[model samples]
Target: MKKIALIFSLAVLLVLGLSTAALAATNGPHGGFTTNTASCAQCHKTHTAQSSHLILFALVSGSQNDIYRTCTYCHSSTGSSHYDEVDGEIKDGSNLWATSAGGFQSMPTVEGATSYTTMATVSSKHNADQANNTLVAIPGGSSALKFELRCDSCHDPHGTQNARQLVPTVTVWNTLGTAYNTVSTIPNGAISMTVNNPTTNETITYNDDHINDFCGACHTDYLQTAVNSGSTQSGTYTSGLYRHRVGMAAAGASGYNAAYFALPTSSPAGDVLCVTCHYAHGTTAAVSSTTYANGSTLLRMDERGVCQDCHRKTFSTSQPAVVAASSYQVSATDKNHVVLAFNSYMEKVSAQTAGNYTVTGTGVTGVSSAQLQPNGVLGKTVLLTLNGSLTTGSSYTITVNTTTVKDLNGLAVSSTGNTFTFSSK
Candidate 1:
């Protein structure tokens, strides 16, 4: 009788194992573990007739649309019972998320009709959907394949180490700031985002090394230690000005100086990346006040304000600082203007030299910084007082010779012909 009871128990164990397998197969792919369980079939089916991509659950993808439907299944307000499915309006909302993991719950969506693609006037945006034109040539890549920017250019469907499942690596966008090398957009990775449960406030953290490697993959120029000595700089570098540096090495947790960057490089848990400055999905164009999105690049903060975060006036080394504060606003906040804005905030200028700041206009005192709107970090216009000349409504050109001004390493900021023009009142 005891032997029979043992045999009955063994039979029950076998049945239980099969039931577990069945349950795994029944669960959807979004939450199921693929390696040891059922499979992606939980989300996609081979014969159920979904999109060209084979995404299932009646989610269809035609020639024109991208993967929005399948992805939003669990990411949208109507789609999932999970957190509020809405764009976080730049991380201000509760329970936000990005296509990248470690992101806030606020994510852009198609059904929600909220993506940079919908911006009528914005020029620089990642067109994640358009099927035909799915690739961009990443600047520093060795071969054509590595340079290809696909539909999911900045994302991964499977999952990754970085937030929102952003691509783990990218080719360096090594531009030399010359006519020969113009820069462009970047790529995403395979797939899958790591998200925290808002109900419990569970969180995940990332390291700066990974952040550096990921962002450095594309934005290679700033991180490059050396500049091109010859007319061209490709696989070669000599000595270049140190950029407001980013990357794992410069991450705050990595013993990098906080006077430069705050803790939590990019994420609240800590570690920084490109997203810390420029919004990955793009923001309203602060590129320029006049023709925004028209031509100016969209930036998270006005170009100069991005600098003010740490360097209230000066950084670690001594050099004529990149102007203490802004006297200018709503103008072009693009790279060329910002980089050359060495004196953008020189409120008062005295003609110490005869031909420099006073070549045509007189040097006066009391001009600092002023702009129309302060926009959080924005300051005022760079004021230059006229001293030697007296004229009303007459225009004059002032040229500042940057070669005379040097950096910490004693490098000239600009060679010649850096000018600003304003009419006399």
Candidate 2:
């Protein structure tokens, strides 16, 4: 019996040992001692340390930007890694040369004059260069959190549980409080990028849904709560706040194309995060379109192509139709107030004219006024006020005149689909 017990104890020990090994962290290259201790010498030195933090500067011969050179040794266009962030290309021994977060800046020539201008159109970048990046107050953070930007400021060389080895902690300003007094950790899995080389025929996927949480770590004021489709305005200001809502569902068959805006897991559709429109690294994309001519802000597409891709307002030649699902929210304070939501962006002047609408229902009177929501001039919803109050729990019908209410593309609202019914609050 004693011999049998010893054999069982040995089996249990083996299982525990295997479990511990499986849970070990495998931080890539810079530090994952459990996987390989040899990686330490690649960046650190014991006796021949060249720089502070024992960083081995022997890899590159540049002293001006030694710290930046170390990271770029494996991450730049001339480096050995699959991701060429310096050139914003994925060079997996293939000809695809797909652009991602556009490169940091122009690549340095072989002569080391730093005048390579392959992506010169990408006028702006994160500026991770150690020599050039200056000490500045964080965009959405407090004065107390002033920091000189660097590659290590955002990335953790030692590794982390989050994707891309993002730094775990940052000091952010609390807008609700009087002082810069919030220390926060980026939520796990808020931003993740998966890319495979074409030589291996791998797919590149980026599902950075809560990326605002990561960017908001420093740009605190830019983060916003999600709003609904009908209430989402394009450009309007009220009480010092812009009405361009982020973190909202970019859903609906009529408003957005499912193919161009497909997300990994958006239930019925995808939500719009910060990275949805902007590239994380940087972009060399040109922006010379007539509608939205602007400087490079690391956008995925040129000019306002990112906006038009999902909004699809300019692309629509189809007649506008009322979306019954979102149009039914009536004002509780004023029973006469009713909101109408359309699938396409409507022209402000025509949609807000009272002469273009007629209201008929139980205990209803003449239409008093029609007004588009102050949210946007090119928004999808319009508010209507009746001359009299609607009966509680009573149904009402409204009609939009054909050829009067038009979309931004000058297509009239469909007369056949003009009539809609809503219950009074």
Candidate 3:
């Protein structure tokens, strides 16, 4: 019995030793550690001890903080030691290159340059943010904002190559219904092109998406753009209209809108490009409380303010004014009014019997006075039916008001006027 116990103890000890060895191997150099790949060492260094943080990269000359250099090393196009050129232009163009066709005064350029005639502004272009690494709050103070432009944020460098270096595939909703859950695979539309490095003859395919997909990924206002361009394209907008002018004209009978093609369809409008509204880098928000305190990082102002940069009138003043509802109550058993289908034989009461009168107001339009039917000689009665799910014991007010309300046709109430009142039954 003693000999058997000794053998069991040795077996347990061996098992624990093997477990520890496996755990270390999973995390240690020979097992999983890899260079030319993403790892903690890719961005940080431990043994050098030159800087307090011991970052792998050197410090930027003019920046006050250490993190600035880490980002500028890869982002700054002019000073970097590693670079390639395509045709006469730099392969990965300088960070200062203009991103827009119609340039703005505030966009950044190579160190001492005055303006970037090529970059687009946020109001007109779709590009990544490269300005600063200051955290801001999302609207409604829901969550802290992301400040840095990391490789993983927009691209998955380790995953399979894709347009824009996207990690996986893109999918979008297809229809609307109560359950309204359907999606369709977005086809791969991006490709890479080989550019001949005149000196070395090395070939590099710069991965990029079709012009429309490149811009649409970030700029979600595609439908609005289509409407402005007078394109009769159909999309997922509430009005079933495509709002942008970038993508292919939606084909099939279901996607076409006759009103959008008032002009000849053959003469297509100008294509919408990615740089139409944004700068690749170097625009900053003002320090004002109204603009910056609630705005996004690298954004000049709040979304509403950015929208106003192009759509000045839509947000400037309230048009298509709406009347505020002063009071309302819901009751399952309370009396309410109703309108019956049109019938010519029904005696339409006039002002002589004002007591048993029909009431109308601007509160709800599309309900014509002619549709109202009198209950008796005095009290205008309306049959109210409660849906089964409505609360049984609740109380409600049935209001009736008389005022000259116009319809969609712009017709006013006849001189007979209208009535308004509310009752709790």
Candidate 4:
């Protein structure tokens, strides 16, 4: 009777094991220990163990790192998967496949190539190799821990709840502190993906929380709390510049027009995220262009094309006009100083022409100079300095003549609302 009871308990345990495997992610190509327990043998050896982490691949000389060698063995162009992470190309049955996460630059031909070919150097990217690459500490973070970065540093092959199997907690071996530090992203929201193959459409949705804070796991002080609120620089970074807000709703943001956007957002309300503009793996975007430099900051688009996704200042079909309600404010300290705000991005050469503006009022002199604020690149505010101060309690009229001021697209400012009046302090 006791032997029969033991057999019954064993059967129950077997059923529970199968149920757990059914719930795991179907990452079969990566040796996902799911329904088929035999998949574990693909990456692990019980008796004849090799390198650290029980990895089956024997350590080769001149390899970047242990885990990288293990992953690229099946992820590179010559590997079984043909998802060459080195060159950021994927092979879908002899055809190149494209994914949201773009590819990297440097790639090797064999398991242990003597020298690597430098195709192109991406301006910005996460360090995946510690042996042959320079170690860059986490930005916005002040941790004094020195460590080696690997591919598995941010990804978990066993499968996870986060999108793309991103591990919730990252463990780094600190060589300086002689210990291990684990950065966590618990209590934050989840980022998920939905692929509709038949329709050839894919949508990524951010839930209640965002990925900005998830990336904040290592980027300690880059947390953005509210929409339109600027992120404060803490830790080591001391740059006091106003920055764009992330991890917040993008639909109702001041400069963002949802109708013009081609990116996905959170359900019900879309929130801007870190990955919304950047590629996690790497990018080959250009760093210099006619309008701007420093463009290749691991962005998904070339130059500032990502900025045009929502700003749309250069894409307006209507004539450029002054924003009356938010413009024409007299400075409290100096009555001669005033500000005028425009609705569209203006042409620097046209907007900064002092002769294009006229000031007429009591005790007011002619305009001295007109300068675009924020150094004029994509700036909409014009700061005007007057020749003489305006008397307090006096009304003044500022006129922007027709065909004088033009938008970035060379559209002249509208003639109807070209005149504005303001009362001096």
User: Against the true structure, what is each candidate's TM-score?
Assistant: 0.43, 0.54, 0.30, 0.57
lDDT of candidate 3 over 365-409, digit per residue (tens): 222222211211111122222222223233332232223222211
Question: Tens digits of per-residue lDDT for model 2 on 100-165?
Answer: 344676421111011232224345566566453345565445455554555665676777555467
Q: Return the top candidate by TM-score.
A: 4
Clashes of 3: 35
Best-first order by lDDT: 4, 2, 1, 3
Q: Model-by-model lDDT, in order?
A: 0.35, 0.56, 0.29, 0.58
Q: Model 2, which residues run further than 4 Å from truth?
A: 1-28, 59-66, 94-96, 106-121, 130-133, 171-183, 189-193, 196-208, 228-239, 252-254, 259-269, 288-294, 316-425
Worst lDDT run of 10 residues, candidate 1, spans 330-339
Q: What stretches of model 3 exceed 4 Å from their correct place?
A: 1-55, 61-68, 74-78, 81-133, 136-152, 155-211, 223-242, 249-272, 275-425
Q: By TM-score, highest first, what's the ranking?
A: 4, 2, 1, 3
Predictions: Cα RMSD each: 19.1, 22.0, 28.0, 21.6
Specify the highest-lDDT model's number: 4
Lowest summed-lDDT stretch of 10 residues in model 2? 107-116
lDDT of 1 by residue, 180-209 (tens): 122223333322223444222333334333
Clashing pairs in 2: 101-282, 102-282, 140-220
How high a TM-score does candidate 4 get? 0.57
